[model samples]
Target: MKAETDFDKAEKLYNQKKYSEAKVLFESFLKENPNNYKSIEYLGDIAGHQKDWNEAIKEYKILKNQFPKTANYWYKYGGALGMKAKSVNKFKALGMIDEIESSFLMASKLDLKHIDSRWALVMLYIELPGIVGGSESKAIKYSNELMNLSKVDGYLSKGFIDEYFKRFTKAEMNYKAAHEIGNSKITFQKLYNLYLNKIKDKFKAQKLKEQFEK
Candidate 1:
């Protein structure tokens, strides 16, 4: 009970944006409950938010191993692996990407509601170098599927809907939906403009016209 209380306090601190203090408390909590999956998950989250992808991968992997049946654990493990892959060499990144896809696929199989896995897979396909794993067509297909699915409520759906799929006209439409939903103006603007930027291909006239036509 005390441990749970401490964990709650640390979580509250994290929510309040007191990262350093939250880290300290979470660390203290983990000293007594080293295998607590939730604590491990939160540690991974804090590390990710700090851009400490290696640490995030470690903690999330531990949680995934400890809780194999939990789709959330695998999804987070894949997400951390994806982030960590960015800093590794190409061969190593490909290996990590494989791990990421495998883990996310497992998560998706366990729970179709695991939208984060879907988004992560699409992101990996889109962002990877062509020689590594990139495929624009695959990215577009996954993104479209995710967009359609995002209309229903669940983890990552709202952000994926507004940020990933909302291209040009769709984005303009979502901007209105975001506002109606009382989403932060700054967040909505970032999503709206970011999508426009992506579809525009550096505002290349031919590319913009082509995508606009699509």
Candidate 2:
């Protein structure tokens, strides 16, 4: 009961973005309930929020090992590793790419309906060089898969890829579809960004902002 109460307090703090206070409570609770996976997951999230990617990686590794069947665990583990790779030298980043890809692939394979892992794979393939398995077609394949899972995500992802490749017109069409379908902040932002940053269309950007804000 005490452990549960402590965990609840920590989780509340964590949700409120009070990482330091939550971390203290979680650590204290962990001392009593060392095997608490939820507590460990919170610690990992806190570490990630603090940009302590190594700590995040360590915690997520434990999570993946403990819950091999959990796609979320593998996703978190892969995400942490990918963040670490971004901070390191190119050679080292190259070395870690396969492991990161494998983890995300495992997560995707484990959960076919998982959107996040597919998005990660899309970005991974799009960003990587051809030598390392980057392929525009592969990215499109995942984007299509995302389209099946969630139309908004699918359109948003397709817009992202089009923007990445400088297909501004295609991106605009897709972003518009996403906003029309979802009408959420993310969709709005994507459309706004394309007009403002990518296409440099102040008229469209202003019109979009006005429409979205209303």
Candidate 3:
């Protein structure tokens, strides 16, 4: 039997979100055909999306080496670094600020059309520490950018948004947003009720009750 085509295998793995496996296939294909920038870029994206930050960083690093004139590679690399720092090593988090911002800045400068890169930069800006990379204004700015990118009213995203903004009242307005969307497979109602009962304040309880009714 003939081996599966590189594209076919990669596509299947990608659809499954099997970044590590997909990346291996992509890398093998790239080794045979180094000019496939799109494949390389997608590999980096998949790695990042899968939260395999180191793999993402490695993929982007390869792209940056191949396409030194473009900033997208660097931007992706920095974003991966930022995620790695944030989710894994708090001590290394601040150190990545310069790398993250620089990549975003370069990507913006190189291609004003790369909304995703810019949006990534914005998110990093929002998540960074105040002494390091945190800025409330920047957070709001990037949050808006992310919302615009998402055409659908994403239930999980909206819930996090409400939680972040302290708009718990509004969260109840769409608590069903997640529940219905997930077909009740994801139970926020149970989690919310748990929190509601844990609170000691009467006014807070009343507020929760009113919000739950909505």
Q: How many residue pairs clash in each candidate?
A: 0, 0, 2
**What lDDT does candidate 2 reach at residue 211?**
88
Q: All candidates' TM-scores?
A: 0.69, 0.97, 0.58
**In lDDT terms, which candidate is top?**
2
lDDT string for model 1 (1-214, tens) is 4455788899999999887788888888899988666777788899989989989989888887877889988988888887777778877877777788888789977886667777777777766777866776666665566656664222223343445444455544554454444455443444445445655434543443354346
- Worst 10-residue lDDT window for candidate 3 reads 182-191
Candidate 3 runs further than 4 Å off? 1-4, 18-21, 68-72, 141-214
List the candidate 1 regions with Cα displacement exceeding 4 Å.
1-4, 152-214
TM-score-better candidate, 1 vs 2:
2
* Candidate 3 Cα deviation (angstroms), residue 47: 3.4
List the candidate numbers ranked by lDDT, top first: 2, 1, 3
Candidate 3 per-residue C-alpha lDDT over 62-134 given as tens digits, one digit per residue, 9 for 90 to 100: 8888887687687777778777877866676667678878877788668756666756655665556678766
lDDT tens per residue, model 2, 125-203? 9999999989999999999999999999999999999999999999999999999999999999999989999999999
Query: What's the true lDDT of residue 74 in model 3?
Result: 73
Residue 180 accuracy (lDDT) in model 1: 43
Q: List the residue pairs that clash in candidate 3.
A: 128-134, 129-134
